[model samples]
Target: MLMIFGTWASQVMSRTLHEASIAEKYEQWMAQYGRTYEDNAEKERRFMIFKDNLEFIENFNNAGNQSHKLGINKFADLTMEEFKATHTGYKSTQPKSSKTVSPFRYNDTEDVPSSLNWIDEGAVTDVKDQRQCGKGITILSFVSSYY
Candidate 1:
């Protein structure tokens, strides 16, 4: 009985160490290539969920005959109910217009520029880190309007 308990304890410790190693690797990868979130309880909770999802995705892909390069670029930390409440309450009240406009016509196709580099023209704004605030759409709209 004592030997059996010792074996079980060793197995548990090995599993715990393996999990810690994976978590450490994930942290290093995040620091190198991913966006950093604030170090808080909420962020920690989201990180754990994200890690579990990533592992599940990796296992599923490996189990299949065909290799699918699946990955998680961002984590949706909010619960489904919370997400629905935040995003579904607002309804647009604007009435639709019945007016039609003629399509734009250009006379000289040769005069049209083939490509544009907004960054080279100094029209693009620097990337902003709006961590956990969810103001990406607003920022993008403001930047696009500048052009």
Candidate 2:
């Protein structure tokens, strides 16, 4: 009867240790998963806000002069400050203009790579009279040439 009691006691002790090891492992995994989830959520939020601000800037840039007269600079400065505060790791990834050309030459030079064969420069049959030249023409040329 003493031997039987010892055997039962040993089994119960082993089972308790086994359960504790499993619980510890489970807790460790949960902590790791929680950190990963939080990191991903933070990245997603930053990207979303960045995208929204970029779209607003693009639309504002495309607007006419009268629309441009609005207090966009003040708003943009405030928004940028807020964005930088929230997303501390954020940095502008935009590359500087590689073309060593002035605005006058940039629009005039047409010798783009042949690999971009999809750009149909002559296909633009119609544009408003005011857009026939200047910045719109430059933008159109760039878009058409890159295609």
lDDT of 1 by residue, 55-78 (tens): 776787888876566665444344
- Against the true structure, candidate 1 reaches a TM-score of 0.44
Q: After superposition, which runs of candidate 1 have C-alpha atoms over 4 Å from their true positions?
A: 72-147
Whole-model Cα lDDT of every candidate shown, in order: 0.64, 0.52
- The alpha-carbon deviation from the true structure for residue 62 of candidate 1, after best TM-score superposition, in angstroms, is 2.8
| Global Cα lDDT for candidate 2 | 0.52
Q: Estimate each model's TM-score.
A: 0.44, 0.24
Report the Cα lDDT for candidate 1. Answer: 0.64
Clashes of each: 0, 0
Assess the local accuracy of residue 27 in candidate 2 as a C-alpha lDDT between 0 and 100.
44
- Model 1 residue 17 CA deviation (Å) reads 1.5
